[model samples]
Every structure is written in structure tokens, then in C-alpha cells.
Target: MNIVRIPFSILLLLLTTSCQPKNKSDKPETPQIVKETVAPKVEISLEELQNYETAYFASGCFWCVEAIFESVKGVKEVFSGYSGGTEKDPTYEQVAYGRTHHAEAVEVYYDPGVISFTELVQVFFGSHDPTTLNRQGPDRGAQYRSIAFYKNEKQKKIIISYIAQLESKNIYGRPIVTEVSEFEIFYKAEEYHQDYEKRNPNNSYIRNVSIPRLNRFKKNFKSYLKEDSH
Candidate 1:
């Protein structure tokens, strides 16, 4: 499957945008960081992508979510972006600071012939704590809330059915607080935000939180992973 790679220069810019001054505790404060790097762009034809379907989800950090969906067999592209809110062209700073209601979300492109939307919903719930309200680990805010954005009635039904099944099985032992919202505009996050975990493998937050989250999902969903991911 085809995927986009962020130039190293863009990675530096994105990380700088995401970094904050180190606090006494582990979480970094929000502030700008500056660095430089570069890379070549690989293009995937539109005709190739027309055979795919799209799904939107927000479970925790986009970095973690992006990485998880990327490993799935049918998933062709996963983009870190902002959605589930009414902000126009929102920036990471605005969303993270609660200036806008949008959550950190990913736009997942996948082939339905290989994987169904039902299975994708299963992955979403399995990967993150859906019981938590407006929070995920160290990141806490409305923008970090759990949400499943559906493109149509059929997709919405799939998400609802999975949540109900999980609840009946008492999977989370708490009420699932995941929001089911109609798909609307998906404002692609800053260029630096795309493919974050892949590019910033050594970044502190990526090392501590992102990678562990991804590993846990990979272990649990081995059957759904791409060969290289395994």
C-alpha cells in the first residue's frame, strides 16, 4: 500500500510546534521548537485510491492512532488531523489549548475488499480506553475525547453495534463514552503532524506513551496487522 512520508524538515517544524517547556512532572508544556531536515515525496495515484474507503476516529493522541491504523492490512493511508468540532482550519495549538472543540483525529483510508468497517470499529475500541471521558493517559481535554466519525448511516450503525456488543460483554467495565458524530470537514493538521510516530520514534512522548500504546494494539490485533507490521 502507498503512504506519504513527511520531509525531515517538516518533522522538526511539527515537533517544535508540539513541544512545550518541560514541567516538573512528565508532560511537556506547549511551546514552539525549531529544527531543520528534508525528505523526498512519494505520490500514490488517485485511481489507485478510488478503490478504498475512508474512516475517521479519535481515541487519544493522533500520533498513536495514526500508527495503529497504519499497521492494519487493508489500511492504505492514515492522516493525523482535526475533526469532531466546528472550528475552521483549526491549528494544533488551538485545539490542544481548548480554543476549538475539535479532537485530535485521523483520516484512515482502507480497502473494504480486504477489511470491513465492522472490524475497523473493533480495532478502535480495542486500542484505547473508551470509558474515559475527555481524557487519555496524560493528555486531558475536550480535544482529546473519544469519538467515531461516520461517513454514512451504514458506518454509524457499525460503530453503534460494536459499542453495544462491547457493553453487553462488559469489556471496559465502565460506560463507553465514545461520541458518534456525522462526518464533516476534516482539516488536515499541520504538515509536521502527519506520520508523527514514524518520524519521531525517539521523541520523549513517542518513546514513553505512543510506542507502548501501539505495541499493545499490535499484540492484541496480530491477525489484522500487515506482514511488515508483525
Candidate 2:
């Protein structure tokens, strides 16, 4: 994806608010009170989540990806996180600035009976430009790279098969650069990052990038989206 220059005023707004910004120094310190207030309420408990299956994906900014998945049917909860790296408990700064190998990722808890892993894989590829290496929209770096994580052989084959089908059909008109990797530990991002799009709709990055990306997904995948999401 090509980088578009934000207007000076919006750029200033992002510098003071966005979690992922063009410049590292642009990130501001979020207040603890703000974090507590903005954190999304978890509708499901850990015990109930154990009854559902979990899928992982890394496609650009988790803020956009998380919102997209949350709108999909059968997805009970979506979490913004860091994955695809060996670093332990990586901080947002470390991952955002390429100090760690981790990429911005999400943990998707879904009901397998309601939405199959195959369909979720479709949503993953459909939501973002997988052909763009180490970049998504205006964000650039390994931290923003696309990755589809599989927890077992069945899930792995499903992801690979879908990619093959896309390639056979020449879906993107370019080689799919998305990484298909085995599942690893996922470090949940700071509380402030959770449900960021919902809480910070006016944020420059959310308005300019995240919401637009999610709207595109909703437009294309209406059947996959929950009724309320429409």
C-alpha cells in the first residue's frame, strides 16, 4: 500500500493520539484514567470463551482488523495484540518502532458452528491487501505485515488452500505476500488499545484509516457481518 501524506493539521492530531503513527515520537502518553474508561467491556468470560474456538491474524493495524472481525457473525470477541515474534510481553513502542519482531495482530474468538475457519480465512484475505509486503495503508514496517496464524494442521491446510485458490484466480494481480505461520503466543496490547476504534471514533487515524478499511470490509462481506453491524 502506498503512503499518503496526511494534512498538517490531521498529522498533528495523530501525533498526539494515534497508537500507530508515521513518526515514532508522534505517540502520546495515554493517561491511566483514560485507559480505564476507554477499555471495552468483555461480554464473555474466560470460562465461556473456552467453549469457543480462537483464530489469529495480523493484517496491518489491529485497530482496523479488530473492528472488522468484531462486526463479523460468530466472532464473540476480538483482541488487539502482538504476535509472530519471540519477544516476551512486547510494548507498543517496541513493536511499533520495529524494536521487536512481533507484528500487530488480533485474537479472534468465534463460534465454529456459526462461522467456519474457512470463512474467517476469507475475511482475513478479503479485508486487507495481502500482496503489500511490510505495509498496509499509510503504515509501514514489519510490525504492519500480513500474517495468517494456524493452531493445527486442519487450520493450516485451510489457510494454504484458500491462498492457492486466490492465487489461481489471480485475485490481487500480484503475488500474495501474506505469511502463513504456526500459532505462537499472543501478547495482549495495552488496555487503551482494546476496542480503540469504537472508543476513539474521532481519532485521526481511526477516522482516516481504520473506519474506512472496516467500511470496505462490511460493504464487501455483508453476509458475514452480524445484523447489528449493518
Best by TM-score: 2
Candidates' TM-scores? 0.84, 0.86
Enumerate clash totals for all models, in the order shown: 3, 0
Candidate 1 structure quality by residue, lDDT tens digits, 1-230: 11111111122223422322234455545645322223322436779777789899998789889999999999998888899989799987778777788999998889988998888888888788887798776667788899998989988888888777777877766798999999998988877767777776777777777787788788778888999999
Candidate 2: regions farther than 4 A off = 1-19, 22-40
Segments of candidate 1 deviating more than 4 angstroms? 1-30, 33-43
**In lDDT terms, which candidate is top?**
2
In the order shown, the candidates' Cα RMSDs to the true structure are 8.0, 6.1
In Å, residue 90's CA in model 2 sits off its true spot by 0.6
Give the Cα-based TM-score of candidate 1 against the true structure.
0.84
